[model samples]
Target: MQRTKVKELLAGAEEGKEVLLKGWVRTKRGNKYVTFIAVNDGSTIHNLQVVAEADKFSEEALKDVTTGAAVAITGELVASQGKGQAFEVQATRIEVLGKADPETYPLQKKAHSLEFLREIAHLRFRTNTFGAVFRVRNTLAFAVHKFFNEKGFVYMHTPIVTASDAEGAGEMFRVTTLDPINPPRNEDGSVNYAEDFFGKATNLTVSGQLEGELAAMAFSDIYTFGPTFRAENSNTTRHLAEFWMIEPEMAFYDLQMNADLAEEFIKYIIRYALENNRDDIAFLGQRLEEEDKSKPQQDRQEMSLLEKLEFVVNNDFERVTYTEAIEILVNSNHYKKKKFQYEVSWGVDLQSEHERYLVEKHFKKPVIVTDYPKDIKAFYMRLNDDGKTVAAMDILAPGIGEIVGGSQREERLEILVERMKGVGIHEEDLWWYLDTRRFGGCPHAGFGLGFERMVQFVTGMGNIRDVIPFPRTPQNAEF
Candidate 1:
């Protein structure tokens, strides 16, 4: 017999039809005559309620059907006598595929703290909260590819290892095969990278934008979605040693065009979730509401989950220059009250508090702050005619500070070389990249969307680690 997914079975499957279902037990309740079991197949957050007769399936076999127990149930569909759900399955035979000891299972019938769940991440997917989050995550990822494909953008797979630093952040995980305790060295006593596997220094890629730009020159428009690594030692919730990034590069695009594409891309995905993953989103929203109940009124979010998602989809993001944003922040009540931990200055990088203030309080919407000082931005960012600011933009969301960061690339060879040199980036290392300008370069622009951050914003998840399965942070690599 073909097995039916819990989602399809719950969604108006013909009653009185025999069905085979397989799932892990979420919870089980029983009396003298009958036993009730709630099962989830990872198809949706809602579980399929199953009713079984105590005499039919022996108590010994039924005892194996507890929380976290995997089972295969052959049953008949019928209207549920219960309150919350519409349909329930009356099982004729119950087979325990796998048994989880009720005494040792980390997840129980009652609510478990998120921190505790993280410790048992290998089993976290079985929980309702994570199940809903990952389903919405799947839809959002597909929506990203769909949005780009519909816009005639080619999907480019950039290499995961490279010699150049795209963002010049200098935080990278080195890839080598040399002995760590004792390795080959040059006459100068420095480690000889020539003796290494790659024959020179190499590291995991931090961004795909640079390579995506090369593809864009020929393809006209290209996007790369792949894993990027940053070896920062910071253990904050916002930082991840390894994460996914989405970068789209286009020829003949300026700063405004890049921002336009980013805004459209964001809205299209959120709207996709609202349409396709409505059930999961609603479940997550309700979960957030339950979590928010313990917070003070002043600390609560201004909008509900659906309301916040709709607001971004419906409204145009407020666009401002870095200079203008600084002025607004300095004169704002937070800065005036000395509540901001980081100083709000014209050239300083905007901190979480500053960015959140602009989006949540000052603008009360998504804000795209552009034209940052060249000193604070990457060498690849296009230098504006003002000779001070680069054509860069950071999109700040109401909850997450900066979800996307991108800039228009420098096209002129001399200027590109100068910018690279000014930043102490040797031209010999980026000869191929400089060749783009040397041969035939046109005005180009691109932006990077942090995949985890977007997931965090869409799902209303506070910690970045919760949004992604198998999060990689400093000193932690547990499954």
Candidate 2:
């Protein structure tokens, strides 16, 4: 007989019916007559209970089978009498598939620090917290596909290696075929990269927006969801060397419409994960309660992820221009108590602290800060009528400072070419981008959302490194 999922077995199956199960022993307790064991098959965090009489299976047989040991069993399904579970199994045959050394296994009955878990990433998925997180991660990815697919968006795969540095921060991980120790030297004493692989020079893509714009021109609506690399050395909770980003490029769309789509997309993902994995969310909530009684009441809110998402999806996003946001921050009563490091001014870029205050304290909801000063935004953003601000918008949530960054592209060929010059970007470097505007261009807009940041925000995870499997950070790249 085929093995049943642990979760399915727990839902009160046929009593006295033969069943086969395979899993790792999570916990075990026994008396003289029989032994009770909890087995989990990696399908879900919840485990199935198995009862075996002393005569049926030797007590010494599994005495050494501690936690994390893999096993299989043939048993009779029966309704559980325990308060913790609704159903269980009565084992007639047992098989030890894999043995885990009790001394070597990192996981124990007690809780382990998140730092400790990071070191053992390969085995972290077996832990309940990580299992729940990755499950939600998988569902969120599917949700992205579902949302874009239904809206007539073409999924495009942009090049992983490119010549353009999208962020213009000069933090690219250089990819070269030549040796660095004694590399080819140009007559000017600089590195000669005429013979480099991919020729000239190349690096891993920081963002797909540039190429994505080319796709949007052809497909009208296109989105690229893939891994993006950054070589920034900052060791913040938010920064990572390698992370996934979602760039949605839309032709004939303005900044406002782009912001609206981003809001809706975020809500849709949270809703999908909640609806599909309600049990896991509930389990986490309960587990958290048992672990930390002093956690904030809002954290314990029984509002299902779907319900919270519904509230966001059905309602209009609170929108405020950058100028208005600065005014609120400058005049808000709460500002009196705290000393802000960076001054909030008309032309200043909003820091994470200010962003947090705006979303968490002022609006108490997701807010879109739009029309930022041109000096602070990217060169591609469309210049607004004010002659100082760009048609850009950033979606800020309560805890996550900026979840999405987007702007309306400069469509006028002359204006775009001029803006490129103003930003000190060479006309030759962005010739193709300029050609797009010269030949066929419509007012386009899009956003780049850090996928790990989104996961961290939705799951209330503190660190970006925790969300991505095998995270690559400065001085911290271990498989």
Candidate 3:
């Protein structure tokens, strides 16, 4: 009596056995004698075909079995005579659980543009492309936890609301419960945050690395995976207003150890996805190939999606210092010809173009650039002996620039206090963060990996908005 998922039925559920299956109809086609219905329950990329005899079910009884309609069918499993699939269901009775009017259902038996699919994101999951993308995303997320758990890392849940800016970028979403039109004000006409919900200023956390550090101090090794928000108004294919981050803090890790762990961690997750979700990933690779055909030959990716994943997993990432990377960029033909839009200098931050050049053109592999200029990096990164560069590192992939960023944290209280003062972060605002260094600080290092960026990398999705379920962007928050 219970309904079996289409996946199970297709995965060799005993043939000739009567079974009940339920799913949404992906497509329905037939002549006067019979109807072939493709049903998919999102268990896998492929759909299960159900054959209904014209004599058994009259046209009136099967009127509601249209595309996008939810249906339950009681049938006998048998070997499929179809060329592509292995097995199918021969329906004896079909019930329309939810009827989708054929005249109004938006999803028809045709290809739709990715831009148009974004408009109907709520229903996009039913499409093959989105279904494949989300399945691979699910695999990657689970693989992240699994990799950390196997390494004895505790999964710590950090607060969503915080008073300190971890990145110090000053692009955080303010969380307030005060009236916007007319509210309490100070003597200088400034908005009073003392009476606010937290009794002081607070906003959605930009990164959980600070709080994650507190837990790492005690737990020895900890990681935080959660949502972070930014109020930046930039609209780009790579930027997202709200995104997820995976930050892992270790009590006694140096820059080298941090880089080693990051390398292992990235490979582990990618290997897991390739092992567990090959079908879904293969589908995405094909989708990318189709999309890339429209692009010019020069803009097309050098390697396919599967090839890129395998390359990252099997190869070692070339490691270089920020100085060396800058030197390489400065001497390259790309830089000599004045092709780089942003200037390439030792003290300046590396742009996406520079990062991509280092990975895709120079190294032809993933690269880890380390020891960045102290002025361009965050205040928390430990200052090197030269006092001009910080012990920071960023992992740059062929397609995605700067997939991971981390550094050895400043453990000396005196130095940390001086760095905080230099950056204008008051000692009072981050007293707790300082407490880690004040009391029992040792050499500690950690790094943050943008979860959506990882998804974008693994899935080969061009737009950052396509990977996340509900993208929150400037002037657009539609479902």
Candidate 4:
């Protein structure tokens, strides 16, 4: 009487049991003796085959059973005599819930490019590729909360709009309710934010690390997982205007502790995905392998997607100082042959190419590069005793590169104020944040992992845009 999910039926539903199955038709084919309809309800990657005998159902009753059409069937579960699936259904009654015209349907039984799919994001979820991608994304997201909960960390929901720019990059989407054409103005003819909402300038937060730190001061261990926005105009495959971030701030955690937790956290989630979504991962891996066939042998990935994930989980990430990383890069044959697109120097921030070289070529595994120069890093990172570098670290993954960026926070009030002033961040803007140090400050550390990047890494999706649904980029925001 009740509908059964395709996943449950396929898992091990009792044979000969009468069941009601509801799902969209993936494909329908028959030789006039019987109709075999492959149906999927998004429960699992595989489809449940519904066999409708020609004698039992007239031609008119099955005429609308096309791809993308929704259907309901009352059938008897039976051991499948087919090659691929273990079990299928023998339909006794059929109902076409909805019909999709085969001629007009954008998605048919054929390959569609990722670019084309982006244009029709609203319908892309119906595709097997996207279905698998989102399912893996779901598993990884749940794993994040589980990992933190098991570690006794409080999940903190930080503000999305704030007056302070955590990264201090000066690229933020302004949040204000004021006339853009002509409205409030200062004596200097500049736009006056004092007359705007919040009574001061505010923007979509670029990172929750600052607010996360405030919560961590009280809770001792907290993490924020939410949407973060950036106003960067870049249209790269890796850059998105709006994305999700996972930031975990911990009290009394030094740089080493931060790195250790990050390493453990990454491996835990990857292992979780592998354990729970093996079929999906395998599908993506095969998809990637097929895609890689078009590229030159040299440019193709050395390892398959599954192999890369397993390698990261089984192996320990190589740890090196920023200076040591630079040394390794400068002396390497890739650097000598001028293969690197960016220069490798002591103070210069390492680019994606350099990070990938360290992880993919030199180390052949994940690497934690630490103690970067203060000039290139944010003001909040703890200054090293040498006064040249900060207690910062970045976890570089093989293909993705720089999956996690974090550092030990500067708990000393005087030093923090000085660093803020040097970066032109007025103390007035974040006095509440400074209060933690003014009262009872201790050494603390945290890191931020871009959620989409993590999904991209796990799914082996080359473009960051493909991993996230409804990606907001330079000039694209289509659903």
Candidate 5:
């Protein structure tokens, strides 16, 4: 018989029809009169209730039906007598496909701490929280592609290994095939990359935006969605050593257009989650509320999950300049009372605390802070007429600070080379990148949205690691 997923079964499959169900058991209750089995196929957050008569199956078959065990049940779908469920399967035949050793199985019906779940990452997918998280994640990812495809943006596959540091942040994972203990050396005794693979120093890409720009030049509009690496040693809940980024570059666009696209893209994905994954999102919202209850009252959020998503889609993002944002923070009561950890300055890079204050406290909405100091932004960002600041923009959300960063690139060849030199980057190292400006380069703009951070924002997941299936951190590479 063909099998039916838990999701379909719970959606009220025709009653009095024989249906086959295959899935792992979530929970099992037994008495002399009857046995109740909760089965889940990872199709939905809800488990399908399966009822079996005491004498329906053999003792050995019934004994193996435990939590984490895989089972197949052939039964007749009927209206559930249970309160919460609408339909259930009345099992006429039961078979144990695989059994989880009851004594050895790690997962139980009870909730597991998020930290403990990380250790058992391999098994975490079987849990409800993770199941819901990944399901929502899948939908959000699909929504990203759908949103861009409908807008005529060509998806570009950029190289994963590169010699150029796009961010010039000096925090990139080196990619090499040299002997670590004893390797090639130069006349000066430094490690010589001349003899190594790639014929020069190379590292995992920090961002595809650079190559993405090359594609945009040809395709007119392009976007990249791929994994990016950073060697920064930050072990906070907000940081991940390896993550994914979505960058879209468009020719003939300005900083304002870039900010508008980011805002529209984010809201599109959030709205998708709100529409497609209602049950899973609802479960996550309740989970977040429960988690927040343990925090201090002052740390509690102002809006609920559904409400936050709706607010972003329905309202316009507040746009301001870095100078204006600085004034707001500097004049705030927190700064006046000396409660701000990082001092507010016109040219200083805004920290997480400052960004959160602007989004969660001051603006109470998503805000796009633009025109940051040229010194603090990437060299490619176009220099404004004032010459002190670049035409850059950063979108900050209420809970997640700086969700998107982009800029109107410097299309002027001479100015770009001068800025690169001022930042100590040799022009010879980026010949092709310079060629773009040397050729028929036009005014263009783009921005990068960290994929994992976006996932954390939509899921209400506190830690960045929880959103991705396998999280690589400073010292922890365990699966």
Candidate 6:
């Protein structure tokens, strides 16, 4: 017989039919009369119970079968005798595919701390939380591609090794072939010997937006969903040394259009996850309820697993200018007590706290804050008529401060050259990019959405590490 998914079988199926199932045992319960085992195959959230009589399957087989052991069972599906379950399989024949010794297996039936789980990432997926997170992560990624592909956006693969600092943050992980102990030096004592990878010096690309923009000019609509690297050492819930970014650049588009695309894109991703992974969401809900059974209903709603996503996906996101958001922050009593470390002026880069307040307290929804100061934004952003702000926007959601960062590109050759010079970015560094503007550039806009942050927001997973399967953080790359 063909193998059947546990979740599919439990949903609705013939009770008396024979089926073959495969998965690792999640838990095992038994009395003297019979034994029951719950197994998950990473197909869905639901686990199938394997019911076998003591006289039917040997006690030695049952004794050898522990949690985390992989097994294949040919059984007859039957209406579940267990409480709150729909269907179960009564094993006719059992096969032990792989045995995970109880003494050696890291994951057990007992609850493990997230930090402890992080140490055993190789086996972490066996846990329900990580399984659901990774599954939704996969779905969200699919939704991103589906949204862009359906809209005629050409997917472009930008280079991982590049010569330009797209964000100008100086946080690149350098890619070189030079000896660190006895490095070659130029006449002025600077690093020399332009014989690095691909001849000259190179490093990992921070954002694909620059190359993505070049592609957009030719393709009219283009996107890049790839891994971006940053060497920043800041340790926080949001920061990661290496993470994936989804960037979409469009030709003949303005800043407003960019913001609108971001809002709609996020909504689509959330809707996709909710529609396809309802069982995982429900499992998380039940776990939360069990974790805090005594909590009041009002308190529960505040931290419900799916409330923020439902709100953002169902409702229209709020849009406001950077100036207006600053005004609200200055006047609001809630923000008055909390002090910001950075300058709170109109042109300064808004801190994470300010962005969070705008979404969580003021707008009470996702807010698109646009028209940021040019000095605080990237060189590619189009300058506004006010002679100060750039046509830049950030999609700030309630839990995750800034989910998407985007801007309308400065297409004018003269204006872009001047902007690049003003930011101290060498014009020669971006000669090819400038050539595109001089030849045939149209008004273009694009944004970068942090993939892990999006997953963190959707799943209400507090740490960025928990969202990614093997999180790459500062000085930490354990499996």
Q: Residue 281 of candidate 3: its Cα lDDT?
A: 88
- Expressed as tens digits, the lDDT of each residue in 250-281 for candidate 3 is 99999999999999999999999999889888
Better of 1 and 2 by lDDT: 1
Shift in Å, residue 365, candidate 2 = 0.5
lDDT of 5: 0.92
Q: Which scores better on TM-score, 4 or 6?
A: 4
Model 6, residue pairs in steric clash: none
TM-score of 1: 0.99
lDDT of 4: 0.94
Runs in model 4 with CA error above 4 Å?
none
List all candidate RMSDs to the true structure.
0.9, 2.3, 1.0, 0.9, 1.0, 2.0
lDDT at 237, model 4: 80
- The Cα local distance difference test for each model comes to 0.92, 0.84, 0.93, 0.94, 0.92, 0.87
lDDT of 6 by residue, 358-401 (tens): 88767788899889888888889999999889899999977679
Evaluated at residue 320, the lDDT of candidate 6 is: 89
Model 2: what TM-score? 0.94
Local accuracy of candidate 4 as per-residue lDDT tens digits, 17-129? 99999999999999879899999999899999999999999889899999999999998999999888999999999999999999999999989999999999998998999
The regions of model 3 sitting more than 4 angstroms off are none
Q: Give the TM-score of candidate 4.
A: 0.99
TM-score winner between candidates 2 and 6: 6
TM-score of each: 0.99, 0.94, 0.98, 0.99, 0.98, 0.96
For model 3, give the 10-residue run with minimal summed lDDT. Answer: 6-15
lDDT of candidate 2 at residue 169, scale 0 to 100: 77
lDDT of 2 by residue, 184-256 (tens): 8899999988877776789999999999999899899999999999999889999999999999999999987
The residue-by-residue lDDT of candidate 5 on 1-479, one tens digit each, is 78888898888856789999999999999788789999999999999999998778655669989999999999999999978899999999988899899999999989899999999999999999999999999999999999999999999999899999999999999889999999889889999999888899999999999899999999998999999999999999888988999999999999888888899899999999889998888899999999899999999877888888889899999999999999999999999999889989888999999999999999999999999999999999999999999999999987879899999999999999999999999999888999999899999999999988888888899899999999999999996
